[model samples]
Target: MTDTLTVKSQRRHLHPAALRIMHWTNAIAMILLIGSGWKIYNDEVLFGWLHFPDWITLGLYAQHGLQWHFFAMWVLMVNGLCYIAYGFYTGRFRRKMLPIWPRAVIADIKAALTFKLAHDDITHYNAVQKTLYVGVILVIVLQVITGWAIWKPVQLSALVNLFYDFQGARLAHFLGMTAIVLFLVVHVALALLVPKTIGAMITGGPKVTADPDTDREPLPSPAE
Candidate 1:
């Protein structure tokens, strides 16, 4: 019991203040982008059956939506770059999100499905969380590239051609938006299910000594 208490006492703040600030900033930027993007999409939807209603959308019209989208785009870009730099410079990504073995991912998936996944140690990310975080980062990068292609097809003709054409970039951007929305849904659901995570992000949670041994090593292969 004492040993368990000692181990728990080793937990530091789950999120640093800088990260939390960037996180909320990114969240606000994404909300604006999505809302305005929806309004833009409604004007000439790729899918006729999937038009967004005005109440949920950001801007009054497509042109207005474009203005909002552009503003949010710059915000997301600057904030995301800062996040990337901080993650690398602080070794936060390496420490918290690396060594994500496939076996570990599979095990975590099974555990989650069985409702046996552990959240007692909020300090560590499960393999599934790591995978989703990395995937969303890549998806966001793709969204930015595709967005540029759509924004200035004539000036960035090379980029537009890379995606096949203007319509293609639009399609890619829409798909990326869908991916981000799905990630948000899952992320929010998990936060609700594990409420402490939200608190950790908000008030920085309980503080303790830094634990150098916290990082998860790769799971051994089956053959081993």
Candidate 2:
């Protein structure tokens, strides 16, 4: 017989139903908002060469794009609020997403940079992931605030004033969207790097196999 031994992988329930629903809803809303927002941004292209083409935009014109953006924004806002509420209700904020301490984040960052970072569990997030998740929530809030201010500078005078001016709010909104796009890239890459992660998001669990790398512990291998 060969020296290598074969064993069946173990499956664990990772994302609950509510979590999956919220995750997908947020994703769809973000995609729509970004597409329409890009169309609107093209109306007054700050940098002429940086505009998105007509084919990829949600709407061909600013007025139409604004309509789509407003619709998506409301959905994103409502879904985000629901997700936050569920996280609090189920203690997910404390149990999963809490970054714990400042030093932990620094330590995690160092480990990641040095290629020494390995996950202890598929169900749990590393400090860096937790920190990013928390930061993204703040970014979403900023996007909403800036979006409202830009959409109605005169009507929402008080909110617009928070950013000092309409232009300031517009700049903040643009920057926030950029951060979100970057986060999406990293998020998708990491999901692909790890097996069954996306499947877990869709189906509530991932089939975890033995971790062959010795630098880190195995992923809970069951006895053969």
Q: Specify the poorest-scoring 10-residue window by lDDT in model 2.
A: 209-218
Local lDDT at 116 for model 1: 96
* lDDT value, residue 176 of candidate 1: 100
Runs with alpha carbons beyond 4 Å of true place in candidate 2: 1-12, 206-224
Which candidate gets the maximum TM-score versus the true structure?
1
In model 2, the Cα lDDT at residue 156 comes to: 94
Instruction: Tell me the deviation in Å of residue 120 in model 1.
Output: 1.1
Question: What's the distance in Å from true for residue 152, model 1?
Answer: 1.5
lDDT, residue 157, candidate 1: 97
Q: Record all residue pairs in model 2 with backbone atoms less than 3 Å apart, i.e. clashing.
A: none
TM-score of each: 0.87, 0.81
